[model samples]
Target: MIYEMTIQFRVSDISKGQHWYETLLNKKPDFIPHDGFAEWELLPGCWLQIAEGIPSIGSGPLRLGIDNLEIERDRLINDLKIEPFDIYSREEVPVKWATFSDPWGNKVGLFEYHNQSEKEDRKKTIVGKQQ
Candidate 1:
């Protein structure tokens, strides 16, 4: 059984990729074992790895859960100079989401749950209760 998981994204330049990820995630990488490689533990067991290499074409639109979609979208556009993207939602779906690309064309997305309580519960499950 898999106890932990990691998702990797390749970029042409490690420095720019690291900086972009730092801005997007709002923190420095938790580990950097060597040059051209970096990682962030997105949750208790989920890791995001960024490396220096040719970026995979049409790789991913890796979605991350957030507390607010609009706030995050605005912040990214303003800080990272990302192109404004649309947030989409369905009547049957419980979350709103938007997708954007990094400079190297890695697709990244953000999503926000409509039910705040559910969001908090998921947060607790991932990181334990907040005091």
Candidate 2:
């Protein structure tokens, strides 16, 4: 049983990133240390933090999903000046989705859950009909 986890973000400007996160999460950051560290307690003990740390390529991947894909995508572009790419598709899995990188080049995703239950959902068959 898991309670919470932090989504760590590395940024060129930690303060600016923290400000952008405040807007995105619609809440003031829980804390901002003078020394290039800021944290927003997203849920209970969980947090999303930005720090002025060096970024490196990593094997572990992180992703986040949103119900409103377009709105989230636009906000990143308009406010944070981050670029994104659409990799996997909605029709491919009955849900619209895309990937975005954070200011520190961490991969993130945007998703719209048009279908939640997998059992009732239909898949395309060889005959081009619902399976």
Candidate 3:
């Protein structure tokens, strides 16, 4: 059976990429095994990998769940100098989301759930596991 998973995003410079991701995630990488490589365990079993190389033309908008999309977006803009992006939502959808790109053109996004109880429950579960 399938188990944990990892997703990778390439960058032209490893040190720059590592610093950029650290600023974006607001935390240091969970692991840096060797030169030109770093990893962050975003969730319990989900890992994000950064490697030094030419980035893919159209790689990904690796979306992350947040407690406050607007707050995070504003911080990304003011602190990271990211251009302001639109936040989108659908009547049928339960979350609001926005997409932006990293310095190396790696697409990234953030999302916030509308249902407070659901969001809190998920946070509790993840935080509990981390504890």
Candidate 4:
């Protein structure tokens, strides 16, 4: 059984990648193991690693669950100067989501559950695990 997981994103330059990710995540990396790598504990057991290399082309829109989709989209657009993107949902879908690319072309996405209680509960679970 898998106890934990990490997703790695490669970029052409570590310095630019680090700064962009720090701004997007609103914090510095939780760990920096070397000159060309950084990692963030995005959730209880989920880690995101950014490394210096050629970025994966057409790989993903790695969607992250969030509390407010619109707010984040707006903030990222303003702060990162990213092209504006729309948040979308369907009647059968439980969450709304938006996808965008980082400076190095890593696809990143954000989503928000339709149920506020469920969202709060998930946040509590993650926070409790951290504490």
Residue range 1-131, candidate 1, lDDT tens digits: 98998999999999999999999999999999999999999988899999999999667888999888999999999999999999999989989999999998889999999999989998898788985
Candidate 3 local lDDT, 31-130, one digit each (tens): 9999999999998788999999999855788999998998999899998898999999999999999998888888998999999988888888766632
Q: How far is candidate 3 from the true structure (C-alpha RMSD, Å)?
A: 1.6
Minimum summed lDDT over a 10-residue window in model 1 is located at 122-131
TM-score of 1: 0.96
TM-score of each: 0.96, 0.64, 0.92, 0.92
lDDT of 4 by residue, 1-131 (tens): 99898999999999999999999999999999889999999977899999999988765778899878988988999999999998899999989988889887789999999999878788787677324
* Predicted model with the maximum TM-score: 1
The clash number for model 2 is: 1
- Native-vs-model 1 lDDT? 0.93
Candidate 1: pairs in clash:
none
What 10-residue stretch in candidate 3 is worst by lDDT? 122-131
> Which residue runs of candidate 2 sit more than 4 Å off their true CA positions?
57-61, 90-94, 116-131
lDDT of each: 0.93, 0.64, 0.91, 0.89
lDDT of 2 at 89: 68
Full candidate order by lDDT, most accurate first: 1, 3, 4, 2
